[model samples]
Target: MTDGIESLLPPAVAIILALITRRVLVPLSIGILVGAATLASQESSGPLSVLTGTASRFIQTIDQSVRDWDHLHVLAFTLLLGAMVGVLESSGSMARMISGWTRRVSTRRGGQSLIGFTGLLIFFDDYANTLLVGGTMRTTADRYGISRAKLAYLVDSTAAPVAGLTLVSTWVATELSYLQEGLADAGIEATNMTFSVFLQSLPYRFYPLLALWFVFVIATSGRDFGPMWAEENAAAQKPRSHHKQSPAGSWADIFAAVMPVGICLIVISGVLVTTGLQEPAESEMSRWQYFGHVIGSGNSYLALVAGGGAGLIAAGTLAIALSGVSWELVIMGSAKGMLQMLPAMAVLWLAWALSSLTGEDQLNTGGYLASILNERLPVEWLPTCVFLLAAFIAFATGTSWGTMAILTPLAVALSINLQQSLLASETLLAASDMGLSGGSPSGTAASLAMSPICLATFSSVLAGAIFGDHCSPLSDTTVLSSRACDCNHVLHVRTQMPYALVVGVTCILFGTLPASWGVSPWISLLISAAVLWVIVRMLGKHPQSAST
Candidate 1:
């Protein structure tokens, strides 16, 4: 359906029902059916025709999604990672690591902070961060009586923002390309200024920076609010007798945990490097640029799959070698972990199916949004509005890359027009005031504000995409965060929503709005932080039973 409002329905329905039902699968399935039905109704108005169209379209969607190599690749990667986690758990690697950590970091706050900080430190790749940090830290969190949902939150909260901020991340290349394209489209000659521009945007990256601060504040303050508080409180009161390991299992070898993860990283790096390896032409200048090009263009999904497979093999071998676990048991545990992923996989499939409905061949949701907003959107307000739009689109489609790819050019073009319009308006005003019919210094000043405004919107698009992906149930990182932390997917979504929203709202209101209105980014950060503090203080309370 090319209908703009209709395009929003499926994801909106799914999100609402998910919140109300506290379950993702049924809602997602219904959403998929509804979307297909919508598509069918577009073909013919009859209810019977719609039913027929939905069945055919739904089957086609599922089959096409499953058969797509990219989809299969991601599915394989996710399931293998789950198997890897299962192997780690059975080998007592997690238990031993957690037991020692528990002894040293005795308090729940310390434990939570450790997990949060670890996620921040593992910033090179979000997938690596989510699976490695969340997977390993879950037991430690449980030992300290932290809720699984809270652990998932900490894991997810740090993954995207940290990865987005880091220079050498998988995200960097993609982000740079989009920005370069936008700048070029805006007639800004940014030749070889990629790194410089990114560095400048660093200060303006209020959402991610503030999000990191939000996590730290919660951890250090030992306070929580919103739905998260209730869960944290209940988790604290629950006895951890089941989490405690016997003295025998305490001797589980560190190598059992370390080796598999090491191999995973090595394999992923090796694959990306090997596959993306290419010689630069004699015309090329910098090695750094060439290497960046290599990394930026690499197939991250393939690399992840390579890592997952290697990890599965290494983990199984290690468990058999060090933990004295039987090969059969290791295999069985791995199988069980793969099976545990079935529910998330089902949800993921439906999410993917829903996304396809708005693609090039289907209804063009992004283009529709652009068309509708083009007439109504003002130039000065472009940054804030663009940020909000990117967030909603990313949340709805559950695809940050898709959202950015669609919106970056549009945002950049809009910003340029807005700036030009402002310059023209200022010139007219200056001429009218001085009784002179020519351009003035005010126009030049307004023209200068153009690039900054564009940059701010670029930052917003990036920030909003990350935030939307952060809280989306259809997001792979969100799903993996729950899988890694062993929390219910919907429950994790519920508990984590408030924290994400606070950072997001603050970034939009205090950061984007003021930054566009001649306000400095540093001031925006201060205001955003102040807002977060006020909200958290007024609403967030220390969960009563949290372990000291």
Candidate 2:
């Protein structure tokens, strides 16, 4: 049950089940049960005891996950965020806003920009963003000769990056909580360092930032290549989306949409800083230090929940007052929105439970992996290795959050162990130039010095997960984006894959590999961006849509 085939069984089984059944919940449940059974069998008193013990452990794992405050917070945040989206949708604010925006998009460039712009604005939730932006802009994109694949690409590309990068989105609380759990498992016991760690990783997250710009470059540059170009050419002579007949929305509807989002951002930021300062400070600190402490100690979960509630109220209130939506109707819409989020929430819960099974002492997936990787994985290659591992897992499973849940702890543990092993040997001296002149700094200094590598590896997990999610045909977001755009899902995947690969390969070569070698992330990002630009410009051609 170590890091060999036995340790691989649960994830392997889960992935196989998923591939065969094409269902998320049941496969994940079976995987967790298998993992629990394995753990119980290892400690069984006798043959018959194994079954009862495994069942007991499986139930215990579920109960433990339910009782976990962090898990509860994530579930609450998802449902609340859903309700907020629901309110906006029901009140006609979102539809009205989209209609208003599409009126000015007379060209393919203009239409693509509108889609990217809308996707960026709806950073609160990727699911909501994908569906809303795709549905709204599909008609305009078609009229402007923008292919369904192109529209789907624009929608799918912007959704995850925007949500992942934004601090107050539904992705944040869950992402940070996993990081916290991972760090704890890895032996980094700093109190409430989730936000601080996230802040550190933000700039280092090269793929998401670069990917977003890639979309912008593709959109504004009027360039197409690969299957996308063929699709663009085909669609130029034909089109489909019905939004052309949709009427322009009133100003009240647009304002209702805008105000709620603005308020959500303001409230979440305000509450994060405020909540972090709730406990009395033991000593005075500089202004920057105080701010750092505040963010570091803040309850990100509550901040998101409060923001979601306030946004929901603001959207509903404005809809009732300005959009002429009845109060009862708004409430019903809210219910609908919350209900729409159930599928995603179910996936999230199963993922969290799976994380508990893998990361906890029950399965010790992280410990087992760390044990195998201690000396075998060079410290410098850790980032790239993790990036590939995460990408493979997410691609196979078609769930980024699920990938994060399963890999974050393992990545954290591996990186920390690699750091410790490197530092405890002469390898650290050769790499960091530690010697008698500076002397091998021991204790806290070594740990502090090792942080950059650790942070880079951590960022790789997220970056790689997004890459897999971006390209995976099995990904729910990909399906929803296609459906929202009224595009054939397989065609959407086909068109997007080439572009995604360009970005993914660029990230692997210039971003993850170099960062692991101690290159600054900013420089790596610049290199990756340049590489992406060359690929797009040299290979891409202007879209041949007759409508253009």
Candidate 3:
């Protein structure tokens, strides 16, 4: 009944089935059913009841997800955003906007670079970044011979890494929440102190930083290898007939697209700061800390829902007033857009359901992985080990947030234990006694000092989880990126994996491993960048060259 091999079966089944079938929904459903059966078998139930129990489990998962306010808000945001995209497409605003931009983006490299830049600007949330970038750029990318698989890659690579690294983002709040719990259990209970630790750990976050740089490298250099190279070459050989004549759109078309996005940003930011200040402050703080705390404590999900609704309305109103589209057409466009999202939304729902089953209350998949760190190890090896472990768990579970929830506390506790053991060595004690005028500091003092290994381990968990998320087909961001580009999900995964694996391997060798041994993360980062540049230049080829 305890967390064990059973916890691994469901995700394993889901991933394998998804790959073998090249489809998501049925595989995800079967995996959930397997998970439910696993849970039910633990109870003393009859065969008939067990079958019925599996159905009950499926229904309950959806019921719980829908009833939760945050989940409901996410669903609302997705639907509204989908409707907005529909309106833009139906009214011809989207096409016209892309046509205007195409003159500036005269080459494939420029188009890819623009997409990457837009992704960086929308750092408030990953979902928003993925959806907005893909929808806005898909046509231009095609005109420039950029493959759908490549477009999906550009959108996905930027979405999570940018959001995760930014100071004020939906990911920051989640990261801070888990870090607070981890620090509290590790005997650093100050609520304000977690923000400081979070900031301190930023420099050591090598994977996200390195992953981002790799995106621009591929964009600017026009160099690619692996499955992506073949995709790009194939796309380049196609007819250049995608947007032969730019639509007769004016400034109104551009405004119809840009205004809604601008409004969405304003509304999300305003609501975040407003809701963050709702409760009275209990302590005085500096302006910087106050701002950081506000962002970390804000109701981001609510902000997202409000922004989505406002954006949808703005797009629809513009389409009707300026685009000369009939109201009926606008309604139909909205309906069509929302309907398109239904399949992706269903996959998202099933993904969330599977994630829930791996929680502490069910199969305890994360718990089982967390238990592995309890074994003692040399303090220097902690970061590398934690990085590998976090990567594996996130790949298996398909959720970075869940991996953080499971590993943060356990990794922090383990780091402290290993540090304590190292400090208690007879040689270390004698050296401390001889070097200092007084005896060693108290245990509390030693434990409170954040060591290099602690910082590396903290960063490792974050970066490794993202690395896994990039490669996992079950990841919601991956699914959204593919859907937004209208790319085949299986093709997206196949093409993206080689790039992710390259960066991931490089991250471990130059980043996590070196930092664990007290090397400067800046140096490690520089080395990693240099190495990647060499790899891309030496091995990569231009799609144009390949096709020629």
Q: Best candidate per TM-score, number?
A: 2
- After superposition, the stretches of candidate 3 with alpha carbons farther than 4 Å from their true spots are 1-24, 27-35, 38-62, 105-212, 218-249, 282-284, 376-501, 512-527, 534-548
Tens digit per residue, CA lDDT, model 3, 1-548: 44787877776677677546656677777887888889877773799888888888878976674575555666677677778767777888755665455567678889888888777866756776787778778787778889999999999999999988985455665565556545544455555455556766887888889989999999989988999999999888887546664554589888886787678778878887897787455498888877876764566667777887888899889988888989999899889878876765666566566666755556766446545544455667888887887777677767676566556655664565456445545445676678953344345512443567878888888888898889988888899999999999999999998898889999989988888888898999999999999999998999864222
lDDT of each residue in 451-541, candidate 1, tens digit only: 5677788788888888888778887789999999899999999999889988998888888888877789999999889888888888888
Model 3 lowest lDDT segment of ten: 440-449
The lDDT per prediction is 0.72, 0.78, 0.75
RMSD (Å) of each candidate, 1 decimal: 8.7, 3.8, 7.3
* Pick by TM-score: 1 or 2, better one: 2
Off by over 4 Å in 2: 1-22, 189-191, 237-248, 278-289, 360-363, 426-450, 544-548
Clash pairs detected, candidate 3: none
- How much lDDT does candidate 1 score? 0.72
Candidate 3: what lDDT?
0.75
Error of 2 at 267 (Å): 2.2
Relative to the unseen true structure, what is the C-alpha lDDT of residue 479 in candidate 1, on a scale of 0 to 100?
93
User: How far off is model 3, as Cα RMSD?
Assistant: 7.3
